[model samples]
Target: METKLTPGGIVWKIFKIIIYSLMVFFSITFVGIFVWVLINSFKTAPDFMQNALGLPEIKWDYQNYFDIFKFEYKNNNLFQMLGNTLIMIAINVICTISFPVMAGYVFGRMEFKGRAKFEAFLYVLMTIPVIGGASAQLKFLSALHLYDSYLGIFILSSGAFGSGMLILTSLFRGLPSAYAEAAYMDGAGEFTVFFKIYYPQAIPLLSINVITSIIAVWNDYMTAYIFLPTHPTIALGLQQLQRTADVHGSDYPLMFAGIILTMLPVFIVFSFIAKNIFNSKDIGALK
Candidate 1:
């Protein structure tokens, strides 16, 4: 049967079209800028200055990419920075995912006293901006001798009470309770039910958190700069590189090369796992 569009439906369709148009416009602009940077990365100093937005000459300089990896600081290179980032990300993933999943499962499924009060506390913590806690965090890290340490960052990031925890809790709440009941009837314990049943269902959300967390940590400069001045993530290192470029502005290609390298790992990781992250229904597709 054919149905006529209501006036409200027409207005909503117009609104969606306008929004989609804007998204496409901005996306194109972003791609254009990225392409410009990539082109400049291969251009010579004279060619870049003369034709900043133009394509590269017949000769493309591939050395900038190589030189960026060779960037040295106290015997550390790009490879060491990669290692440090992976290590921090590994600890962060374990701590963030494990605690949140457990906490979410408990809050969403289990009946316990003071649950309302605990949730209120989490809401308060979530509403409080992190900037307000900077000084106290510094003091706490100092007291524990965790300043300039990956373990310190891990501890800070592994909180069970946050927006992510709340989101996971809500997701778990929305899931059917029949699965849990069936598992329990089969003699499955709380841990077994959560791990084998609930956790698999939550994998999609978990993947989203993992990607966002990795990107956040990868691009964060201020936190690492304040707490771990000795340890330089890619963002901090890029900032240092840009500062050096201020002295030698002509070597802009090198800086652009570094920028590309900085984005590479994130691109690779997302390309591999993006389907799993976004597809909430397609469980175990990758495996």
Candidate 2:
């Protein structure tokens, strides 16, 4: 059975083809660049400049990677910086996840006076784009004596509101009240009911948020630059490397190697999650 394509269907097919072609083209471009960088990472500076985009014809210098392990910024080595970044991510995840879960339950389930107004206020706060606010924030932090310390960064990042609150609000609001009521009837307190029942239900959303926060924190250098200047993370170290390269001549191949090393962790993590992103269970709907 041969069916002729209508004009509208033909146009739609052309549109789809164009979109697919662009995606493939960009993917190839990205992969090509990545391969070029990786190839250069193993070459000597002279070799890299000689054949920037080609395979390493000179000695396959693996010493570049070893040099990165030895690299230091502000007395913090790569390992120490990695540890700091992990700590930052851990603190953020704990704060962000725990606070939102509680807030979501309270705002979504418990009806109190001015509850709607409070929720509205949170929304309003989210809408206000914070540009710097550095002076007031510094003053406040100085008042508390938390400036330039791990605790200060922890306190700042561990806020219990904003985007996470909104996301989890919808999830908790849609949850059935029957289970909570049953738990209450069984002499369970609010905390117990929340921990035992509601918390388990929101694990999927929480897990995804944790993964996202890890990646964001891993890539973030600006916050660390401001708050944790003494303890530079991988991203911050990369920035320091760039500065050093500019002022003092750097081994270009070694710099490329360092760049790739810093990128690999986040790249691996995102790749792992991206594959299973859609394969996971349907989110928001509780078991």
Candidate 3:
């Protein structure tokens, strides 16, 4: 079949071309900057200052990677800061998956009195910015003695609400109820129906949520700064490292090295889960 392009089709094609061009331009710019930083990270302070935009004159300075571990901020070494960041990221991912799974399944699949109102409430809660209640939240956490503690941060981040809830709820609703009904006919318990049946099906969506939570929490410094002054995460530590580098002067290469090191974990995590996220078949399957 031959089709002629209409005026609207021509306009849409032009729009798409413009959008793709912008995307390509920005992607190249980002990669160029990243490569420049990586190349400079290998050079000495003076070498970097002399040729900020050029490649290294000598072999790569592998020591810069090791030196990152030795860098300290407020008595917290790189290892300690990395550990703190990992802990928070792990807690955030777990809570985001687990809490949303249970809550979303219940509200999405089951019929119960006041369920509509509860869903409405969750939607309203999403409208409220987290920072809007920072003062009260800080006071509340302090009153409960959760401030500056891992458990406190875990609890604070483990709310069974927000955009994730809405997404999971919709995901559950899209699924056929026959699966759960069959499991029930076989005398399966609620736990089996949820954990064994539908939960496994939700893994793809959950993986996406995990990646998002990890990246968000990994890059988050403000929350940790106020709630956990004693336990600085990688992001907070990076800020401190930058300040310390500035004080010493001519240590921008080392600061860039730290930035690369901090970014590596996020890249690794995303790579591992990227496959699962893109393959929607795993999530779309009835089984």
Candidate 4:
């Protein structure tokens, strides 16, 4: 069966080919970089320098991976650092997702005065970077006596004006209002209507927020470096390992190994949710 292609069909095929080619190119580059890092993770500093793009010079290159656990950063072992990271993820995830979803419900479903303006304000603020005010933030944390504390970092990271707010807002808006009306008819109050009627439906979208927070909090080192001096995370520990590498004299491979371990959790989690997170219609995809 032979069929002649239209001009539009031929153009579409060409576009498809170009897109596929780019995906393949970028995928290869990404995988190649990761593989290179993994390979280098096994090599000694000298071995890495000598055979940057090749296999490890020595047969037994797994010692660096072991050294990660053996070495301690400021008296905090790698597992303790990992524990701190997990705790941070839990606290930050709850703080970040909880308030936004609550506010998302209010502004999203319930119409009120200045709602649109408030939403606009959040959108404007989103474009503004908070990087410049690090000193002020540090001072603020100190003023609250929360300096170098988990609570301080939690408060700092849990801003409501983020994509979670926007996405969950849209999700709530797209939901059926009839459920709330039915709840109200059953003598349910606002809290009941929200908790019983609406909140459950939002789990999928909220999971996205949780997943994002987990990855973000997992990778965030600066906050821990600044505010959690007592607790070191894998991300911050990796940097500390590099900075102290001269003193250690051979921890470069250990640093590389730590890097791999640090990214492993995020990589595994992203693999599962990449399609959903990357989807064009985020709210619609959940529904």
Candidate 5:
């Protein structure tokens, strides 16, 4: 059976088709670029630029992977650089997750003098631009003999005292006090209630916040550049590579290899947590 469409309906349908086509085109283009990079990562310098947009012209040069780690200057291996990046990321994740959870719990549950003042302080801290604080933080770390150290960068990145507090405070505020009250009546102390009741309920929000913090820290370059000057992270290292290439011609294959390596961990982590991060479960409903 054939159904006839009105002229207006036909026009509308055509518009919808065009819109969808554009969306698909853009999506494919984005994926294609990454695919190109991934494939070219396995190519030699000559073949990479010559046939970058085409399929691999020869056997996948697995040596590209080996060469990346092997091509070292000044006795620094790429593997060590990757380890440093992972260490920084790990520190950021720990501080972002733990500090925010406890601070959020306090802001949400505890009643004490200067509570409002402390909350206000957090808000003020959030308003201070990160760039402005970098110099002063570096100096403070220097005074404390923490300059050019992993601990210094960890402390700077992990100072999750502001945005994390805000996000968790909102989540905590939305939680029902009835649960805590009941726990209190049941002979549960403050710590007991927080650990046994509140912590369990906050997991979903915590997961989301942790994922967010991970993405931020992973992509961050300025802080890594300024504070971790001696210890270059993936972001800083990539920037340095780009600068080097600009000065001394391009090495497309090596560049693409570096990019693919840089993005692989983030892709894996997000793929694992994508389901939970996007889950629609209500944190407040957790009993």
Candidate 6:
């Protein structure tokens, strides 16, 4: 049945159409990019150039996967590169999760004379780019004889010196104070109150932070490039592959394979934690 549309109804219908159009545009763009990457990961250079926008005519080439682990154009071994990348990411994730949880709790719940000033200091520090401090960090590491070592990379990555702490602090503050107060009234120590009460309430936010930090460190190239240039991680290895493409020219399939491999662990981890990220009630109150 056709009903007469008022001016307001017509405007509303137009607005809905605009919104739907935008949504469809973005969705198609995202899917197209993803499919392109997936297809390119299996195609040789010639095939890719010929059928850049088409589906794979042949089965997905497993040779790309094999080459990522075994092929060597430069001195770097792909297996070692993968290991180093995993190790760096692990160290970063561990430090990012553990330190921020404790620091956030302290900043959020604990009382101190210079607490406001301390938080202000962190906020200010976050403004300074990591690259800006690289030279100083190198000098300090050189002084301690930690240069070119895994420990050096770990320390540099772990320094929870940014928005992570602040985000956790806000989440902690949003938590109910009644639990801590009750624990305190029951003669529980500060440590006990934090561990037994507040910490539990912060798991969801903590998981979100961990996932973000993991992805950042995993996908990072610049810091790893500058700090451990000789020691090639997966990101660095991918960069090397791209750089040497003139000599090995048009190895898009292998390069894409390396990228997919690099992203696999992060995808797996995110899939596990994604549910928690979307549902705050499972972890604790952010509001």
Per-candidate local distance difference test = 0.81, 0.82, 0.85, 0.83, 0.76, 0.78
Question: Is 4 or 6 the stronger prediction by lDDT?
Answer: 4
Q: Where does model 6 exceed 4 Å of error?
A: 1-16, 57-60, 73-75, 121-131, 278-287
TM-score of 4: 0.84
What is the lDDT for 222 in model 2? 88
Positional deviation of residue 62's Cα in model 2 after best superposition, in angstroms: 0.9
Stretches of model 3 off by over 4 angstroms after superposition: 1-15, 129-131, 275-287
Over 131-229, each residue of candidate 6 has an lDDT whose tens digit, in order, gives 767789999889998887889988876665456667678778778888778878899998898888888777767767778777887788887787776
Worst 10 residues of 5 by lDDT: 278-287
Better of 5 and 6 by lDDT: 6
RMSD of each: 4.4, 2.8, 3.4, 3.3, 4.3, 3.7
Instruction: Count the clashes in each prediction.
Output: 0, 0, 0, 0, 0, 0
Better of 2 and 4 by lDDT: 4
Candidate 4 segments whose C-alpha is farther than 4 A from its true place: 1-19, 44-49, 120-131, 246-250, 283-287
TM-score, model 5 to reference: 0.82
Model 5, 1-287: lDDT tens digits are: 98899999999999999999999999999998899789888887777767867767876776766666764433446776777777877887788778878988888778899999988887787777766666788789999999889888777766656655766777787788898898788899988988888888878777776776677777777776777677776777777767766776757677778788878888887887788766745434432
Higher TM-score: candidate 3 or 6?
Answer: 3
- Model number with the top TM-score: 2
Q: Which 10 successive residues of model 6 have the least lDDT summed?
A: 278-287
C-alpha lDDT (0 to 100) for residue 242 of candidate 2: 80
lDDT of 2 by residue, 199-283 (tens): 8888877777777788899989988887777888889998888888777664777878988997898888878677455665534
**Candidate 6 overall lDDT versus native:** 0.78
Off by over 4 Å in 2: 248-250, 279-287
